[model samples]
Target: MNFDLTEERQMLQDTLRRYLRDKYTTSVRNEIIDSDTGLSDSIWAELAELGVLGALFTEEQGGFGGAGFDIAVVFEELGRAGVVEPVLDSVLMGGRLLAAAGKSDMVEEVIAGALHLAVAHGEPGGRYDLDHVHTQADGDTLTGRKAVVMNAEAADHLIVSARDGDAIGLYLVAQGAPGLTIQGYPLLAGGRAAEVTLDKTPATPLGLTLADYEAVNTLALVAISAEALGAMETATALTKDYLMTRKQFGRPIGTFQALAHRMSDLLIELEQVRSAVINAAGNLEAHDRDLHLSATKNLIGRAGRLVAEEAIQMHGGIAMTQEYELAHIAKRIIMADHRFGDTDYHLERFIALSAA
Candidate 1:
């Protein structure tokens, strides 16, 4: 399928790019990063005003009637601007999870820009296996722990993945639920994460079938792969700009054939990953999803790593400093590598799938 974006998609991308550049500043991101909330209310207000927070949902649910690609576009712009808000966890993951679970009552709250959402699915022991879950939910009560829960403090709701009578499922838990405790854990990329402990926390089952679970989880992975595209593009752009201005050997470094070729190779790899992302998103109901998603996630992880490393190299010592956002951008992608899924483990599964 052609990945050419439609006119609406183009418009949304352009609008978000402009908005991020104008409104979201390094200082603003720093403010949120330094605060307890780990979120900039003003920036979120701006996002809501720009319709970015609700850019990729249905009109009936107060969304902008956008697609996954549209959300990808917004993420790219945010990545370039070094947005600190948890757009992926709050809007994309949360919105999709709710919609998939047949929860429309929160749609207006979400779209009206009132509620932010997060997912607590990764356990401390690890979800790399994806099936060896240890969390438990019984009769509207849950008891478990999830780590690396992004934007947990800011989220109004959380979609907790847990096991119920030997069946892995999702639960929608109110942030204020009685037995739930959240402790902050910030990342190197200037965002607030947390370790969430649910001690018999109140929750409502998502009522998902086996097929639904598989599809939603795979789509979420693919969706995150799409977000990785954003960070990769920004890192590439930063590298390109750095090479353009920074002098080396008394000349613009980018003019050097060796560095130019390296940038070209990075660009090619990024394009290949982009193709893989598109293919993965399209192969939703294909016979072998584990293979498709694993390959896609692996490619995205590699592409993200390559772009970030090369960008840092091009930026020299300044890349690691707080002055430039490239370092933080790289860090976010690197950490994002472990979220939703891990590349090496998934690649092993992909190989196992292909072997059969």
Candidate 2:
């Protein structure tokens, strides 16, 4: 039960950490977020060249690695840097879905960072249910609305989920397809999301049926849980540093027994989240993957909320300001809970899975 990363993964971790540390500062990220597309083509290309994108898929999928650990490693780094790119949406979720559907051409473009893709699976009032799809597909035409479609505006293609008869199916919709409209806006954290409107839009079927859709959705949960762990680590470290440095009543606030105790609790929660993420990642391909994923996401949602609250409270007003790094990380943790499934949602799911 060793948690140590393999040499290749460790190297990938180091390389990605260095690249993001040098290039993804708050100011640079701000510029990217403020831009028309809210993305950096140069940085995206750099990530592709560094094999960050390739690491999320296997050789069979037109890349080098596609294991659960690979996805966890890449996304953890992305979370650490608070990167606003659509790598999670495009690579982890959409690219993997394409790979599973045997869409080698699109997966290759994704690995090469030549194109962006997003999954438009969520809809208004869906309430975190992956199969609660209202979008309908008939004869290669899709008609429905998808809510919070991350990176849709910047995507070259969208892997949209739709109801085909009684089963869920995935389709590929090209950018600016007829009768397709995207209303893009910034997320509370850093990236952009769109409300996608499809009015009998033409689409290409991806050959993925209901079972594949469920599997991909569950994998997405594990990926984001790992990402949330990275963000919580950053937030916790930032809070601890602030406590150790910020003077209060002629001494550092960290010297106070009350604050020190609180910090210790945060560290314990962080460790718990780390363990949950590891467990979920390891069991991602197992038969009972849904059980592990639900449990992991539930723990992540709860622990992430605790970390976000404690970090913000410890930092006072500074952590709430957008100009600081912890604020964004905190936002990421808080918002990640809402994505995939929140604490209550996963908790209920875990209970049902356990009972069955």
Candidate 3:
């Protein structure tokens, strides 16, 4: 398969980059961080109007006949801009799961941007092993505790993975369901996450088969990995720019041989990670299940941490300051390591799979 960006994708990415750069400049992010609302609702509306919210779904589901690469383009731009939007959680979590489960009716509403949805997957334990879930779905009620649900409070709907009878399944829980309570919180990164507790909360079943569940979850992980790559790339560029302008002993600090070599090594790792992201994204529709996500997430975990640390080191004290973009970038990268699975987690899984 050819690894190339189509004309439409190029158009989509360039437009998003320009729009976000203007509207979500560093000032905007800083303001949002301090505001009563963690994010700008107006910006979210703009994204929906720009068709970005619906661009990853197919036309059959009321979308523009888009693809995963379409999502990759938008996410890359968002990462570069350090955007804090729930669009990723909306599409990657609820929208993809709906599509994977063949819920075309619900999928249409999501693609049309009428409903904001999130996946309440994480539990008391940090592990994302959905199949080993302890949450129970009893009739129309679900009882469980979910932590760090990305944009959970903002979601109109939530797709929760839980243990159903003898099988692991998904439950569609409305945000307004009785006995459901959500408390908003901030992630270590510059984004917001929520904790949701359900005590016999009313819910509908997604009825997705095991294959569909796995595919949707894996695709979400790969999507996050792509975003991580973008964050690292942006952080590295910012670091390099800072080094060139920052002077020591009446000369640009970047001229030092040791720092130059360190930047070079980090850049190489970034390129390798880019290749991994592209390969995994391209194979999102392919037959190989574990190989695609495992490779991408593992590479992202490694690259995200490595590049972020180097970027900080190059920026000196400024990098650690919360006011600096580098601080947010580094936080996002570190969170990515724990997002889908850290390097240690995915690497171990891959090794076990290889042995099997």
Candidate maximizing lDDT: 2
How far is 347's C-alpha from truth in model 2 (Å)?
Answer: 0.5
RMSD of 2: 1.2
Q: What's each prediction's clash count?
A: 0, 1, 0
Ranking by lDDT: 2, 3, 1
lDDT of 1: 0.78
TM-score of each: 0.90, 0.97, 0.93
How well does model 2 score by local distance difference test? 0.89
In model 1, the runs with Cα more than 4 Å from the true position are: 59-66, 209-213, 285-290
Which portions of model 3 show Cα errors greater than 4 Å? 35-37, 101-106
lDDT of 2 at 31: 85
TM-score of 3: 0.93
lDDT (Cα, 0-100) at 63 in candidate 1:
80
Choose 1 or 3, whichever is better by lDDT: 3
Model 2 per-residue lDDT tens digits across residues 81-118: 88888888888888989988888887889888998998
lDDT scores of the candidates, listed in order: 0.78, 0.89, 0.79
Descending-TM-score candidate ranking: 2, 3, 1
Candidate 2, residue 161: the lDDT equals: 89
- Candidate 2 regions exceeding 4 Å error are none
Q: What's the TM for model 1?
A: 0.90
Query: In model 3, what lDDT does residue 276 have?
Result: 87
